[model samples]
Target: MSAKPFSQGVKSPIVHTPSSSSTTGPEQDERSTPTADLKSAHRKVDRRLVLWYSFVYLIMRIHVSNISNTAIINLEEGDGIKAQLGGLTSQQWAWVLSIFYYPYMLLEPFATLALKRFTPRLWMARIMVTWGIVSMCQGATVNYAGIMACRFFLGAAEAGFYPGVLYHFSFWFPTQRLSFRIVDPETAAFLSGPEREAIIADLPSRAPSMDSKTFDLDQIKAMFRNPTFVPFLVIWITHGIGGFGITFVLPTVIYELGISDTAISQLMTMPAYAAVFLILLTLGYFTHTKRLSPWVAGIGLEVAQIIFYILLITVDNATAKYIFVVIATAATQSFFPIIWPERIRATSGTTSAGLAIGITNGVTQLMGIVGPQVYQPKFGPSYRVSYSTSVGLLTATVATIGLTWLLVRRQDKRTEAAAIVESEGVGLPGEKDRTKQQGC
Candidate 1:
C-alpha cells in the first residue's frame, strides 16, 4: 500500500498491521523503514509461522485431494466406496465429487471476511478441525445421500482457508515473503515485548488497512477494476478446472493403467505429489531469492503443464504415461500458487486483498465442481480427451498470465509516475510543473 513498489519484495519495507482492538498498533506515518533490525523479524516469522502454516496447508491439500484416492482405498476386493453407496452411476459419482465445491465457491468470500470477527488463529483452526470432522464422516457414510451430504459440508468447512491465509499475509509481509507470516499486538502472545513493539509500532509505514472494517463494499467493488482481477480470475478458472481435473482422477488413471493389485496404484500416486512439493519449494526459492515476478513464475509453470498435457494426450506407452502424469501435476500445482503472490501484489489494502483473493479462489473452486466430470468412466483407459482439455486450458492460462503482467506493469508505471509527481510536488508550483514536464 506504500508508494514504494513492493511487487518484488526485496527492497520493500518491513510493514506491519495490527488488529483494530489492539492497544499497540502500526505507525501511520510514511517513511523509509529501517532495514537494519529486520533480521530478527524475518527469522521470527520463519520460525513461528512459516513451517507451521506449511504443515497446515499440507493437511488441507491432502484432504482436498483425498477423494480421488479414497475412491480406490479398498479396491480390487469389491469393497470400494462407489459399491458401498448404492452402486453409484457415473453421473452420480461425478456429482458426489462435484458437490464439495458448491458451498466452497459460494461461502469462500464471506468466510474470509470473518477472519476479523473471530481472529485468524481461532477461525482457521476451526475450519481445519471442522473439515477433518466432515472428512471423518465420509469414512462412516453408508449411502449415496450420506456421502453427498458429507462432501457438501466438507466444502463448506474448507471454504475460507486459502483466502483467509492470503488476507493474513497482507498484514505481515510484502508479496513474496508473505508466504510465511502472521501477527498483531493483540495476538503477539508468542513474541517478546520488544519484538511485539517492533511489529506493531505506529508508523505511516504500517499497512494501509490494518484497521479496515470487516466488510467494505467499496473495496470489493474496486477489485473489479484492478488491472489484475479478471486476468487472475481467468488463470484460476483454467488451473482449477484443468489442474484439479488431473489431480482428482490421477489415482483412477493410475489404476486403469494396470499398475497391479492391492495399494500399488494408490501408492504410485504419491510420487506426483512429491514432485509437486519439490516444484513448489523450488518456485518459492526463486520468488524469494531471485525476486521473480509471479507472472514469470506462472507462465513458466503453465508452459510446462501445456507441454506435458500435450505429451499425455498423444503418447501411448504405459511407463511414459505415468511419467507425464507426474510432470503435469507438478506443473499445475506449482503454477497454482503463483496466483496468490500476484493477487496480493495487485491489490493494495487488506479488504481489497482479501476479497479479491476470495473471489479468485471462488472461481478456482469451479475446478472441484467441474473437474471430476472431465474424467468420467466413459473416458477411461487413456483419457486423451481430458488431457486435451487440460492442454487447452493451460494454454489459455498462459495467455492470461501475459495479459495480467502487461496490465499490472501498466498500473505500476502509472503509480510510479503519480508517486514521482507527489514527491516532487513538495516545492513551488512552477517547480512541480517542471518536474511533471520532465516526467512527461
Candidate 2:
C-alpha cells in the first residue's frame, strides 16, 4: 500500500492527452468555427464586388427614376426637348409610359431561365450595357412613337435583372443568412465539393436534385398553390399602381401646391424621394431584426398610405397636402423589400424560386400600364380621381396582407404539429402501429 507513487519512475503505461491546440479534429473544427470568422476572411473580396455592384445599381436606379423627372421638366420648361414632345397629350404620355411594361412583363420569366443557363456576371453586363444604350436613345426620341419604341426596347433589355439578382442570391445563401443582405462568398465556395455533399445529405427528400439542370413546369405550377405567392402578387401590383401614380404626378402636384417657380417645384419633390430611400433602408433593418412578418408591415404601410391619400384629396391647406404626399410616397415604396424576401423564402428549389420571382415581378409590373392612366391631366391640380383610386388600391393591399398572414400562421402550426408527431414516433391520427409506419 505504501508503494512508490505513479510519478516516482513508475512508468505508468504512457497515457496520451491531446493538447489544447490539437483537441478538435477537422470536422469538429469546421462545425465549431464561427460564421463571422469565415465571412471576415472573405471580406476583402466581398467588399470589392459589393462596391462594383452598388455603382451599377445606382446607375440603374437613376436610369429608371429619371423618366419621371424628365417628363416633368419637359412638360413644365417647354424648351428644347420639351418643345419637341410637349405637344403630346397626357393620354399619349401615359401610353409611352405604359408601353415599357409590355415587353418587360412578357419576357421576364424567359430572361430568368436564361440566367440559369448562363453566368450572372456575363448576363448582367449585357443587360446593363444594352439598357444604357436604350436609355440614351429614349432621350433622343423626337415624338411619342419614338419614345415609346425606345421605352419598349429598354424594358426588354432590363426585364429580369432585379429578379435575376434575387435568384442568384438564393443560389449563394442559406435560408437563415438570406436576411443579412450581404454577399457571402464563403457559402458559395463551400457549396462545391465534400461540404456541399454533406449539406445536401441533410436536406429533405423533396429538395431539388443536384443533377437536374432544366426548369420544371410542375414546380412552377405548384408555386401558384403556395399561400404566400398570390398575396405577394396582389400586394406588389397594388403598391406599384399607387406608387407610380404618385411618382409621375409628384412634380405637377408640387407646382399646383402654389410653388410657382418650375425649379422650386422640382426641388420640392426631392425631399419626398429622399424620404422614400431612407424609409426603405430603415424598414428593412427593423423588419429583419424583429423577424416581423412582411404582411404585417405591408398592412401597416398601406393603412398609412390610405390615410395620406384621403388627406391629399380632402385637405385644402397647401402645406398639409404636401406633407401627406411625401408620407404617402414613402409608404408606398417601402413595402417591396419587406415582401420580396418573404415570398422568395417560401419557395424551395432553385428553379422554382427563379420562376416564382420572375412571374411575380413580371405580373406585378403590369401596374406600369395602369399607373399612368390613373394620373391623367384632366384630374390635375386636385387629382381627386387619382387619390381616390390610390386609397382604393391601398385598401385592397391591406386585405391581401391580412389574408397572407393568416395563411402563414396556419402553415406554421401544421409544420410544428408534424414535427411533434415525428419526434414522438407517433403515426398520424388515423394510422395505427407507429413502428410499422416508421418507413412511411
Candidate 3:
C-alpha cells in the first residue's frame, strides 16, 4: 500500500475499500445503532404519554361538563339529580352554572405559574385529585348555595389542568409537531432549526437566568403588542362564547325538539357527541396527511356552523333540526383543536407562551358566565336568541381568523425577504451563509 500525501493547501487523499459501499466503519456503525434505537424508544414513550394524558383530559372534560346535564335534569319535574338536591330557578341556576367559571378564570394564570414551580406530573395530579373531590361533593349539595360553592371550588381546582397539559406538551414536542393540523412541505422547508429553538427558548420560565431578564410589565406589554397575540385572544374568546352557548343547553335543546323522555334526550346527545368525535379524528387525520392549513379548515368549519345555526333558527321539521344540531356540535367542537396549536406556535418562550395560554384560557372561560346568561329561561324551548347570538359570534370568529391569516402571510413575506438579504452578504471562507439556503 502507498502512503497518501496531504498538501498544505489541499485535503488528504481518499481511500475506498472494495466493500466500502456495503459496510460502515466500526465507529460509524456503533454511533448509528444507538441513535436509531434511542429515536425508536423516544417515539414509543411519546405515544404512551400522549395516550395517557389524552385519557386524563377526556375525564376532566366529562367531569366539568356534567353540570350542564345536571342542570337540565333538575329543571325536570320528576326525580332527577337536580330535583333530589335543591331545585333552582332559571336565573338561580344560571348563577350556579356561571360561578364555577369565576374562580376558574381567576386561577388559570396563577396555575401556569405553579406548573412552572412544581413539576407538571405533580401539579397536574394535584389538580385532578382535588377537582375530582370537588365534583363528588356536588352530589351532596342541598341548595343553590351548596351547589354554587361546590362548583366554585371545582372551578378553582380544575382551572390550570387544560393549560398545564398544553404547556407540558410544548416541552416535549416542537411547535409544528405539537400542532394538531398538518404542515405543508413548502412551509416545513422554510422552518429553520434556529427559529424553532428561539420559539422554545422564549417559553416563560420560573427561574430567570443571570444574564436573561424575567417576565415583567414590559414583556407582558410586548406580548399583547405582538400582532399574532391579539387576534388569538379575540378568536379564543369568541370561540368560547359560541361553543359554550350551545353546549351548556344542548340536552335541553334536544328535549325541546319533541323528545319527551328525559332518558331518550340524554341518550340522543350520545350519538351527536360520538359523531363529533369521529369527525374530529377524521379531520385530524385528513388535515395531517393532506398538509392542509388549519386556518382554512377552521374557517370552513365555522362557516358550516353559521349555516347550521341559521337552519336551526328557521327550520320547522324536528328531525331536520336534530340533524343540524348534530352537525353544528361536531363542527364547533372540531374548530378548537385546529386553532389552539396556532396560538401556542405564535408565541416565543415558556413565560410568554404560558402567559398567552393562561390569558387565553382564563379569559375564554368567562364564556361560562356569558353562556348560561344567553340561554336564559325567558327564551325557553326555542331559544331563538341563543342561536342568533351564536351565529353572530361565529361570524366574528371568521373575520378574526381571516385577519390573522393576512398577518401571518405578511410576516412570512418579510421573513423570506430578510433571509434573502442576509444570504447575499459575504461571509467567512468555507462557510456558506445558510439564512436563505434554509428557506426560513
Candidate 4:
C-alpha cells in the first residue's frame, strides 16, 4: 500500500506560472485583436455613431440652412431699398455677400488651433447661439449698411461651427467604418431647406423679424481643447466650397429658367427638404446597418450636383433648364450632413473635434462670402458665371475626397504595420535586452 502511494507525486515544470495578480514578472502582451472582435466593435460603434450624428444633423440643418437663406435674401432686400436711397448697383449687392468672408476666412486657422483645446459640445452651442441671434437680426435691418453689418457679424459667429462638427464625427468611425462621407450631404440638405424656407419666409408680403444677439467667447474658447476631430477639417473644406457655389446662386439660376419668383422660392425649398428627409432616413439605416460608404455617397452626390449645374447652364431649352435646376437643387442639398460631422469625428475626441470642425467651417465659409463675387460677373450673364463656378467647385471637391481616401488608406497600412512590428518583438537597439531582463 505504501509503494503504490509513492508513485503519484507530480513533477513541476521549470518555469512557474506567474500569478495573475503579480506585477513583478514580465508583463504579458495582449494578443492581436480577433477578427470577430474587431468586426463586432466596428459594427456596434458604426450604428451608434451614425444614429447620433444623424439626429444632431437634423437639428443643425433646420437652424443653419434657414440662416443662410435669410442672410442672402435680406441682403438683396436691403440692397434693393438702399438702391432707391443711395442708388447702389448689383455689384454692391455682390460686395455685401463677398465682404462677409474677410473676417470669417481670417479666423478659421486660429479657430483650428483653438480646437486643440476645447470640447465640441460647448463650442457648437456657442456658435449656434451667436448665429441664431445674427440670423434673426438680418430681419431687423432698415438699410443696406445695417444689413451689411449684420451679415459681417453673422459670418463671424457661424465661422467655426461646420468645421468643428466635422472634427467631432471622426472620433468613433475609422476608415473601415465608412462614416466620414456621411457628414456633407446631410448638412447641405438641412441648410438648403431652411434657406429655402427663409426665401419663402421673406416673400414680398411675409418676412419674419430677425434679431442680432451676442454670445460668450469664453465658452467657445473652452471647446478648443476637446480632442476628437481628426476627419473634420478636410471633409468640411471639400464640401464647403461646393455648398457655397450652390447656395450663392441656385435661386438666381432658378429664376432664369422661367420659374416665377414665388414658385422658385417655394420649389427651391423642396430639394433641401427632400434632402433632409432622405439623410435622416439614410443615416438611420446605413450607419446602423453598416451598409453604406459615406465617401461613395458623398462624392456621388457632389458629382450629381456638378452634372446638374452643367446641364442647367449648357441646355438651350427653358424646360430642360428648369428640370435640371430642380434635380440639381435636390441632389446638392443632400451632401452637407454626411460630410460635415464626419470631419469632426476624424479629428478624434469631441472637444478637439469641435474646434477642428469649427475651424474648417469658418474657413470654408469665406468661400461663401467670396462666391457671390466670383459668380457675380464683371459685365454679363451671372447665371453662366454661377453655373460654371459650381462646376469648378464640384471638381475640386472630388479631388479633395480622393486625397482624403488616400490619407485614410495610408493610416490603415501604418496601423497594420505597427501592430505587426509590435508582435514580432523587433525591439529598438538597446531595448531588447532590457525587455528580456524585465521579463517583458
Candidate 5:
C-alpha cells in the first residue's frame, strides 16, 4: 500500500472483517494483520495506556467503593459511619449507596459530547479534580442528609469518567485492540512525526465521513434502525442487573455471611475485585488472539455466574458463600471488556457510536440504583430474592446476546449478498471493498 502525505485524522486499527461470502480471493482475506512497526508501536501504546489509565481508573473506583468499605471500617472501635452519623440505619445507608447511581447513570451519554468539546486530557483532569473535592466533602458530613447531598454531588462529579474513558478508548484503538486504549496520533507528543504518521496510516478506515466533533442525530436514528441496536442496549441493562448488580452490593453481601470479624469480611471484598482483574486479563488475552467469539465467551461467562449465584443461594456455610461470591463477581465483570470493543465498532458512523456508547454505558449503571435496593435489609440472611433475580437476568443476558449475534450475522449476510451482486457485474465476483480514506 502507498499513500500521499495528508492528515485524515485517525480511525480504528482493527479491520471489521466482512462475512465469508464477501471475499473469494485469498489476497483479500481478513488476516491482513498489522506491520511489525505498528505492532511494536501498539505494544508501547498498550504499556502507557494500561499502566497510566489503570492507576487513574483505580483511584476513581477506590473513591466510589469507599462508601461500601466504610460500613466495616474501624469495626474494632465500633466507630464507623453508622456510629459516627447519628447511628445511620441500614436502610438509610442503602439510600446513600443508591443516590450516587442516579446522576452517574443519567449523564453518561452526554459525557461523550463533553469529551468532544474539551478533549480527553482537559476533560479527564477536570473530572478527577471536581470529584476529588466532592469526595473529600463526603468525609466531613455530619448527618444523613449531609452525606446524601455529598453522595449526590459526588455522583454528578464522577458522571463522565467511565463513559469518557470508554469513548477515549474507542477513539484511539481499533475495534480489535479495544479489548485492550486512548491516544491520538495527531496530538501525541511522545511519538516522532514519522511514527505518528505511521500509526495513523495503519488504522483501517471504517468511516471517515463524520468529524469526531460532529453530533448527528440522524446517524443515531439510523443506529436505532439497525437490528443489533436494541439487543445491545438490552445487553447493557441485563448484564448490569445480573453481573454488576452483585458487584454493587458485594461488600454488604460479604458482611451478611455471618462472619464475626467485620474487618475480615471487609478484607474478603478485595479478593472478589482481584478475581475480576485476573479473569478479565485471561478473557482479554484469548479474545485478542481471535480464538474465541466475544458473544460466545460472554454467554459462557453468564452461564458460569448463573451457576455460581445458584450455589450462593443454596449454601449455608459462610466460607462457601464467600467463595461463590468471589467467583461470581469475577465471571460477571470479565465479559464487559470482551464485548465493549465489538459493541462500539458495530455502529455505522462516529456520531452514532458516541451517543449509543454513552446511553448504553449509562444504562449499565442502572443496576447500581436497583442492586442496592434489591439487597435491602428485608432480603438479607438468605437474600434469595437478590440471588434468584440475578439468575433470571443472567439467563436473559445470554438470550439477548445470542439474539444480537444472529441479527448482526443476518445483516452481514445481506451486505454480502448485495456485494455479491455488485461484484457479479463489475470488478471481481464476491469482492466487497471497504471504504478507504483519501490519499491512501
Candidate 6:
C-alpha cells in the first residue's frame, strides 16, 4: 500500500492489526486477566497470624489440659483431701474435687471482654502465671478445705485464657482461613499475611508506632462488631457444664481402673503433657493446611467421649478400661483450645473480648459446683450417675455444634453471595443494596 504523504495530499494509510500494547478499543478486555490475578493475591493468607495463633493455642493447651493432669497427679499421690484430713467422706471429697469448674466457667465471657481492653500478651501471661501458681498451691494444701480453696482459686485464675486466645484468633483470621489457620501452622501463617499487610498499609494513616505503653483503641473497637459473638455464648455454656462434669469424675474413674489411688494420679499426669503436645501438633498442622474445621475436630472428640464412658462402665477388664481412659482423656482435652478461640472470633473486635471470655468462664464454672454433688457415694460407689451425666452433656455439645454449624453456614452463604455479586458488578436483583448506602 502507498504510504500517506505530507500535508494531507494522499489518503491516510489504513491501520491493520493492533499491537499487543495497543491503547485503543477493547482495552477493558485486555485488563481482565490482570484484574483476576490481583483478586487472587488479595485473598492469600498472611504468615504472622499463623505464628501468633499457634502460640496462643499452645498456651491454652497447657492451661486447660493441665487441670486433668494435676488431678490425676494428686490421685496417684493419694494427696486428696480425704487422705490428708480426718473424718472426711466420699461425698465431701467429691464436693472439693468439683469446685474448680465454677469460677472458670463463670469468668469466660467477661474475660473475653477484658481481652479487648488490654494487650493480650500481658493479660494472658498474667492469667497463666497466676493459675500456674495456684496449681503449685494445690500441691501444698494440707487438708480438704485447703485443697477446695485452691481449686476455686485455680478456676478463677485460669478462666480467661482459652477465650482470650480465641478472641485474638478472630482479630487476625478471616472466615475462609479460620480453622486451618488455627490448627495448621503453615496455613495459619499464610492467612495472617493479609492482616499484617493491612496494618502495615495503614501505618501512614496512623501516628508513628509508639512504645508498649501506648494502645490501639481503633483495633479494639473492631471486636464488638464481629457477628460471631452471640452464638458462641451458648456454646461456652455447654462447654462449662461438660468440663466440670467430667473433671469431677476423673479421680473416681481412675479408682475404677483397678489402679491404686496413687498410681491413678500419676497416670493422669501423662495425658496433661500429652494434650499440650498433641494440640500443638494437630492445630499447628491443620490450621496451616486448612484441611478441617476446628469445630468438627472438637465436637468429634466430645462425641467420642461417650464411647469411652461406655467402655469404662461396661468393661470389667482393668487393662482395657485403663487404655480406653487414656485415649478418651487425650481426645477430650484437645478440644478446649480449638473451640474457645473459634467461638470468640465469631463476634470479635469488641472492647468486650475480656468480659465475654470471663462470663463464659463463670457459667461453665457452675458445672464444677453441681457435678460432684450429683455423683456423691451416698448415691453409690460406682458413680454411674457421673458417667451418664457426662454422656448426656457431651451429646448436648454435639447438638450445639450442629446448630452452630447450620447458623455459620447460613452466614457464610450470605457472605459468599455478596462477594460474588460484588465481583460481577451486579446488584442483588430484589434486595436493597444496603452495603452500597450503608458501610458494612
Mind sharing the TM-score for model 6? 0.63
Query: Which portions of model 6 miss their true places by more than 4 Å?
Result: 1-80, 128-150, 175-234, 248-252, 268-288, 295-299, 340-342, 351-362, 374-381, 419-440
C-alpha RMSD for every candidate: 6.9, 13.9, 13.3, 18.3, 5.6, 15.7
Query: Using TM-score as the measure, which candidate wins?
Result: 5
- What TM-score does each of the candidates earn? 0.85, 0.80, 0.78, 0.60, 0.86, 0.63
Regions of candidate 3 where Cα sits further than 4 Å from its true position: 1-42, 74-77, 179-218, 415-440
The pairs that clash in candidate 5 are none
Cα lDDT of model 4 by residue, 186-228, tens digit: 1222234543243222211100011101122432443333222
Write the residue-wise lDDT of candidate 5 on 1-440 in tens digits.
01111110111222232332121222224324666656766666666554656678778778777777777777678887778888987788778889988998888778755766666667777888999899889878899999999988888888877766665555445555555542465566666676666566644344322244357665656666666777888998888877787666667678877875677777888787788777777766676666766777788899999999999878789888888989988888777777776665565455665666677778888788887777775687788888899899889999998888786666555555544555566544333432111001
Alpha carbon lDDT of residue 428, candidate 4?
Answer: 53
Q: Give the per-residue lDDT of model 6 (tens digit) for 1-440.
A: 00100000000000111111111123223332333323343344223334544565566555555544443345445664455665468677666657776677666666655544555546666787898798788777777778779978987887766555544443333322333343111123333555434522321111112121123354334433334444455565565555445554565566655556655455554664476466646764564344556667767777777788777667777667667667666666566556653443332223333344445445655656776676565554455666677677777778877776665454434544554575678888643342221110
Backbone collision tally, model 3: 9
Say which candidate scores most in lDDT: 5
Candidate 3 vs 5: which has more lDDT: 5
CA lDDT, candidate 3, residue 14: 11
- Which runs in model 5 stand beyond 4 Å of their true positions? 1-31, 75-78, 181-183, 207-213, 415-440
Candidate 2 minimal-lDDT segment of 10 residues: 2-11
Model 4, position 155, has a per-residue lDDT of 70
User: Which scores better on TM-score, 3 or 6?
Assistant: 3
Name the better of 2 and 4 by lDDT: 2
